[model samples]
Target: MPELLIDIPSTFVERIERLAAEENESLEDMAMLLLRRGYDFAVTRPEVEPDRSQRPGARSDARLDWWREARFGLFIHWGLYSVPAGVWKGRDWPGIAEWLMYRAEIPVQEYEKLAAQFNPVKFDAKAWVSLAKRAGQKYLVITSKHHDGFCLFDSAVTDYDMVDATPFKRDVLKELAEACAAQGIKLGFYYSQTQDWHHPDGDGNDWDFDPAEKDFAGYIEDYVKPHVRELLTNYGPIGIIWFDTPKGISEEQSRSLLALCNELQPDCLVCGRLGNALGDYATAGDNRIPEEVLDLDWETPATINDSWSYKINDHNWKSSVDLIRKLVDIVSKGGNYLLNVGPTGEGVIPQPNVERLEAMGRWLEVNGEAVYGTQPGPIQGRADLRTTSKEGVIYLHVFDWPADGQIRVEGVAAQGARLLAGGAALPVEVSSGALVISVPEEAPDEAATVIALR
Candidate 1:
């Protein structure tokens, strides 16, 4: 499509921007909305939804039911950047290892050399999917391509991919898709649509490609769209197409990518970072959980440790207890938790990550009913206690057990109560117009104990 240039008043542009922010939409969407309203007024007819049911591979809202019920997932960040492991020329970068190429300001040619060394010989698709299943993760989203423009899957669009660029020469995404299917876990892919440092026409390579002379449209049509098509066509029923860092992408481009995903696989979801607020689900900021419950579908993507990719010096890891609590907190607020694991260049998930995930798996083995397929509880903003509900039964997740052997909750009357983990009954009484449940002094589980109320 050819670009349409129009001149609008500066005041109108500002107003459009404000409206977009208020509605959580893009400025272009707002402008188009205004145009649509004007046209409706002139036509004297009510607005109608586009008839998409007849379209090829038409999308259905039913596809998202599984995602809504799935409270936990795994995120993998692996690419050429893992080869350097945040150390470029003997200097340890202090931030995310995935952004090493841009942070170090390495030339495109120099960064391309990393692809030759990007041999993940130990990468095991079945083992990775098995870990997610054991951790009680319902889905897995891997980085098909990162901002560094390195691809983990085979891409006919470019030879700058794992299959053709490295010694391992394997399509990890293909193997992962197969493994996930066999394990009954949903699969997703993370592709950096706008930012491709190696491609001159793509965004975010100012060190080499002059932005003024770049043909971003060419990058989108010739490269981005093709890559996306191949992913949706090759991968069997992808759970999500996770795009990141919209950068300078236009609303039209965002919609085009979203439409393509819909056309290829109607069930596959598009994340919020696709830009223009066109995603099927909203994505929270990195490592951030909402302070209050959200009415819409949303998710929080977080790292097990500080860096998303492997960094030899970054030993700081979140404890299993903390991770469990975080998962409970997110679920209580009607959101999904996508925890990340950064594998080494040798294709090994760090031992620390493995231990933490195993611990989480053990915790979920006992209390998974409280986390999975549950809705947000009526209670809100309680630090010590969070709640999840399913089939009219409420489950209280106690992070900090009371020492007095009594836990009181207002505005709720429990006919009966029992420990979800152990199925042991507890005494419940109505006192001061509140339901007080008597329990043991010591918590049944340190990482958020679940008590079911009937």
Candidate 2:
């Protein structure tokens, strides 16, 4: 008999051996059983090549055309942290709800207890995807694994996942993937590559593990890489692998992760947080937009409220008017708006979040032409006014409707002007190298009113 060798992470090998014993089968037969369950032993290229080439120490634009044109997307941050909802031992932590573990410095054994009670019976994949679609989001990104190191999908590498550990026993990511496909929305995963508080060797667990003795490289090889591989392999086609908190990740480690994404799903985009400026696009700070237009492709990830994860007391929701205006501002500055929602532990999006999204959807139904597939307009540096352009037409987004019924747009030569909401032409005149247009005394929409000029 000849011997065949397969090199994989030790964790997977242990899983296979354990299964072999439980099933009363040979090791090879157990390996075959695992393979039959859709386990990919090796990385293989898909039929189509990536859109852009990747070079060492350089970021590749690879398949971001749809992302750039999308203009807006949905970000979901759901995990065990949602179960706590930002209160630890009856004390409400005041910050991002997801950082409850790190902020309070809870013990691993105690924090892991949340898994026993983690059951989101109300989670509806179809409904979630439909909401994103209704909100005019072209793509969706969910946190597959956050800093707490909780896994939302079934992993052969570990059992501390939604399926095995939690009472829900359902793979949330799998359901979301199917729903996204059915709804025609691109899917992306947010994985915390560097910070895994649960694991002893993983970064950000100083309370449990001695940092001096921890083998960070070993953790990357055994845990992080395996999880990333599992994500790319199990999912049908991932749009983006959004990594967060690079902290102490080495340049070599970042490149290695990039190589894995390239090898498995070349079309999948790697965001800048993967570290060392090797992402297809740059990501702005949380809830922070750039002051000026960045030369490279960038996106601003913002929360619907102040918290990224669900917080019972965090009622400070941004108004629909402010959110709509924020969307216009980001697009005008040549960036994508990744609006986030923190669903309750019961799997229901807070009603306020739903209402805001619906309102934005209604706003988009009439003014989508001004937003979708548009470029940053020629006009810049105005707080009350922002602009987006498609083809030769420019869209003037008036956040603060001029009460005087007259507005002046600089550096534009307009032959005609009309309201996008009503298609009613307005009077226009040229004066002092600017186009002055007459408007209604009252704005049609409270959020933002658009004027199309050509």
Best by lDDT: 1
Residue 223 displacement (Å), model 2: 0.8
TM-score of each: 0.87, 0.86
Candidate 2: give its CA RMSD in angstroms: 15.2
Candidate 1 lDDT by residue in tens digits, 156-239: 899999999998999999999999999999999999999988899989877777889999999999999999999999988899
- Per-candidate Cα lDDT values, in order, are 0.88, 0.87
Q: Looking at model 1, report the run of 10 residues with the lowest lDDT sum.
A: 46-55
In the range 126-204, model 2's lDDT, one tens digit per residue, is 9999999999999999999999999999999998999999999999999999999999999999999999999888898
Give per-residue lDDT, candidate 1, residue 378.
81
